[model samples]
Target: MTKVAVLGAGSWGTALAAVLASNGHDCTLWSRRTEQAEEIAEKHTNEQYLPGAVLPDTLKADHNLARAVSGASIIVMAVPTKGIRKVCRDLNSVLEGPVLFAHVSKGIEPDTHKRISEVMEEELDREICQGIVVLSGPSHAEEVIRNQPTTVTVAAKNTEHARRVQDLFMNQSFRVYTNDDVVGVEIGGALKNIIALAAGVTDGLGYGDNAKAALITRGLAEITRLGVAMGANPLTFSGLSGLGDLIVTCTSVHSRNWRAGNMLGKGKSLDEVLDSMGMVVEGVRTTKAAHQLSKECGVPMPITEALYAVLFEGQKPIDRVELLMGRMKKNETEDLAGWS
Candidate 1:
């Protein structure tokens, strides 16, 4: 049994910790709040984030950072993107030895435009971090905790490390795949949330499937364009992290981004939508970073730009939809011609 420490007590972290514990690994989940830690340990349920889901009894919880990571050989970071750097720094300060790190957060740093793994690398000491791996795809925490069949990919610059993570998480109900295209995986996972938000808006606006389908398709195009310019393989955009993730996040009620966008489309202000959700909608922050990235990379992301206006400039969601639909005509495959 491998020793694992999953940082953060959110739904994703708790679900992953349950997976590890069920695999007979020595796993501990760390929560910043002592009450949360006690609740998880004694009750085996993180109702705040994952209501009605019971965690594995063998799984342990701790509020102390040092205690949670004391003897762990693998550290799973499931905190939000904004918390990644601080968690990495905290882990580095307390870690006694180098450990493999796997992150499940999907987001782009607002100002730095760094992926979650990048943020980890920047904050973690090399001496304490053996490798960085990103675990992502279409999987949802609610389904995962229920032992539902789920597939996900783990990527890293170090193929060996990626394989190690694949083994650590793979089980009959949960399938794990490995990839060396870290850039593609990270980019696909992060940007899909933006598209999901737009998709949600479409639903809230009472638009039909046609509009949602168009958003998903065009969203993939722009995401691939930006990802390719950033040194990722274009083909990876068609894989689990890309198309697969987009389909699920854009349609599922579990997606916070989609739900938030739905509220916006239904006439709720951005502040009201955010205030009601009470969860970190990664897409809201990612939209800002993605808007900046598109401009910086010279990629035309009309959907992202429209969403940005509605989200930040106080433009009406209906107007944003009009803006997108009324754009000048261009060859759909023109941008993809060079890819082939």
Candidate 2:
């Protein structure tokens, strides 16, 4: 069994640790809080993040950074995008040798607009990191922990490292696929949350499936436009990370982004929704980053702009929707001819 350290105790991290432990890997989950670590070890349940899920008994938890990564040859970074740099720096200080790093979090760095892998490369010592891989798709932690059938993709510039991560997590209930398009995968994963939030707003506004469907479809168009400008393959947006993830995040109750948007659409202030959820709604932050990125990339991301206005500029969600619907008309496939 391979030794793996999952460097976050949040739902996704805990669920991934459970997957590793179930596959007979010696997996340790690390949390910044000693109490959280102890709770996972003793209770086999992270009540705060993952309420009813029971983790594998063989899985270990550690509060100490050094202790958690001591013997691990593989590190699964599950920290939020906001915390990635600090965690990578901490890991770099304690790492003894080169190791394969796999990150599952999705979101662009607000100021730098760097993808998670780029941030990792900046913070982690080259001598200590063998390669950086991103693990992402439509899988949710709640369903994954239940051993429900799930499929996800791992991507890296090095195909070998991506396949290595695939082997580490694949099982009867969990399936893994490998892709070489790291930019596409990361972009698709990060931007879907923004569309999901817009979808939630549609639902909250009492708009029917027509509006939701349009948001998701047009949202993919916007995401693909930006991703292509940033050097990603257009076809990747049609795969699991793009269309699949967008659908799930936009529809599911388990999505924090969707829930937060729903609250906002129903008239709760941004601060109120955030306070009530008690968890990070990545879309909130990503919307700002995406809005800035669209401008920098010379891409038109109307939905992202609208969401940014609603979330940050105090424009009403309904007014933003009106703004979107009132945009200048063009052929649906106007800019997509070159993508094929």
Candidate 3:
């Protein structure tokens, strides 16, 4: 069994640690809070994050970062995008040799506009890092904790690294697929949160299924357009990390981004919405990065533009929706052709 360290005690991180432990690996989950770590280690429950669920008996927890990763062969980075660099710096100070990293966070860094893997590679010392892998898809933490059947994709520049992650996480209830398109996988995983938030807004506005269907379809188009522009395989957007993640995050009540968007659609201030949702809404941050990317890449992301206005430009959500609906028409086929 592999010695695995999962950094982060959030719902996703805790649930993944349970999976690793259930697979008979020596998995240790690290939480910044000492009390939370003690409670999880002794009580076998992370009540705040994974309420009503009991973690695996073998799963351990640690408040100390260095102790958690000591002798670990694989490090599962489940922290939010914003904390990645700090965590990498900490790991660099303590780590002794090259270790494989599989980051589950999905977001594009604003200003720098780098993917999570890029940020990790930049922050982590070259000699101590073996490679970077991304594991992402439509699976939600709530469902995964219940052992509900879920499938996700792991992508990396090295096919061997991707396969290793696949083997580590794959099980009867949790299926893992391997992909080599790191750019497409990362882009799809990061951008779906943006679409999910928009979808939540539509739901809040009481827009019916037709509006949502159109938004999702067009959102996929925008994602595909931008992904292709960023040197990613367009076909990857159709796979689990792309269209699949978009559908689940946009439609599911379990999605934090959707919930935050729903609050915005119902007329809550962005500050208020963020305050209420204790978890990080990746979509909110990703929207800003995607908007910037659209400008830089010369890609027309009307939905992203509309959402950006609502999110940052002080425009009402409904007004932005109207603006989106009122935009001049374009040939759908012609738009798809532009992605090439």
Candidate 4:
């Protein structure tokens, strides 16, 4: 069994720690709050983030980033995207061993539009860093905590790295597939949250299944457009990280993005929605970044654009929906038609 370090104590991170420990790996869960770490270590519970899930006894916890991560064969990054750079920079100071990375984050850097792997490479800056891997799919912290069957894909620049992670996490309830399309995998994971929020908006407006079906179908088109524009394999968007993730997030009640969007669609302000959700609604920030990327990369994402208008420009949500519904039908162009 390999030793693994989990660098967050949030719901998703805690669930990941439980899985790693159940898989017979020695796992250390690290948190900035020592008390929270202490609670998980001693009581086997993280009452705030993951209610109703009993953590494994094998899951060790610590506050010191160095102590938790030291000498681990794999470092599982379960933190949000915004925290990755700071955590990596800090972890680099005390780590002496070569550690392979497996991150489950999903968001693009707003300023640079960098993928999570790019952010890792930028912060770590070591040739001997072992390898970098990204795992993403429809898995939610809630269901996975119940040991429900969930499937995910691991993508790395190197196929060897993907295979190694597959051995590390794949099991009876949690299955992992390997892929080499790093760009597509990362892009799909980040982009799907936006579509999920859009799905919630439609639901909030009381639109029927037809609207949601259209949004999911056409949203895949937009995600594919952006992924291809940014050098991802066109086919990857059709895979699990792309279409599979989109399906889960857009429909499932467990999706935080969908929850946040439900509030927004019901005419809640951004701050209000965020306050209600109590979790970092990644899609809110990603919508801003994606709107910026559409302009930079010359990609036309009408769905994203309308969502942005509702989110940032104070456009009424129902009005935006009506506008989208009234858009003229034409031959669906293949290459993000209006982007050019």
lDDT of each: 0.92, 0.93, 0.94, 0.90
For model 2, residues 1-340, the per-residue Cα lDDT tens digits are 9999999898899999999999999999999999999999999999999898889999999999999999899999999999999998888789999999999999999989999999999999999999999999998899999999998989999989998999999999999989999999999999999999999898999999999989999999999999999999999999999998999899999999999889999999999999999888988889899999999989999999999999999999999998888989899988697566
- Tens-digit per-residue lDDT, 1-340, candidate 4: 9999999899899998899899999999999998999999999999999887899988999999989988898999988899999998987788887889999999999978888899998999594378899999888999998999999999998888899999998789999999998989998999999999999999988888999999999999999988889988888888899999999999999999999888888878988888888778888878888889989999889999999998889898899888888998767775555334
Model 3: per-residue lDDT, tens digit, 1-340?
9999999999999999999999999999999999999989999998988899999989999999999999998999999999999999999999997899999999999999999999999999998899999999999999999999999999999999999899999999999999999999999999999999999999999999999999999999999999999999988999999999999999999999999999999999999999999999999999999999999999999999999999999899898888898988888887678555
- Residue 308, candidate 3: Cα error in Å is 0.7
Which 10 residues in a row give candidate 1 its minimum summed lDDT?
331-340
Q: Find the 10 residues in a row with the least total lDDT in model 4.
A: 331-340
Candidate 1 overall lDDT versus native: 0.92
Per-candidate alpha-carbon RMSD to the true structure: 0.8, 0.7, 0.7, 1.9
> Which of the numbered candidates is closest to the native, going by highest lDDT?
3
- In terms of TM-score, how similar is model 3 to the real structure? 0.99
**Clash pairs for candidate 1:** none
Q: Please, what is the TM-score per model?
A: 0.99, 0.99, 0.99, 0.96
Error of 3 at 254 (Å): 0.3
Clashes of each: 0, 0, 0, 0
Candidate 1 structure, TM-score to reference: 0.99
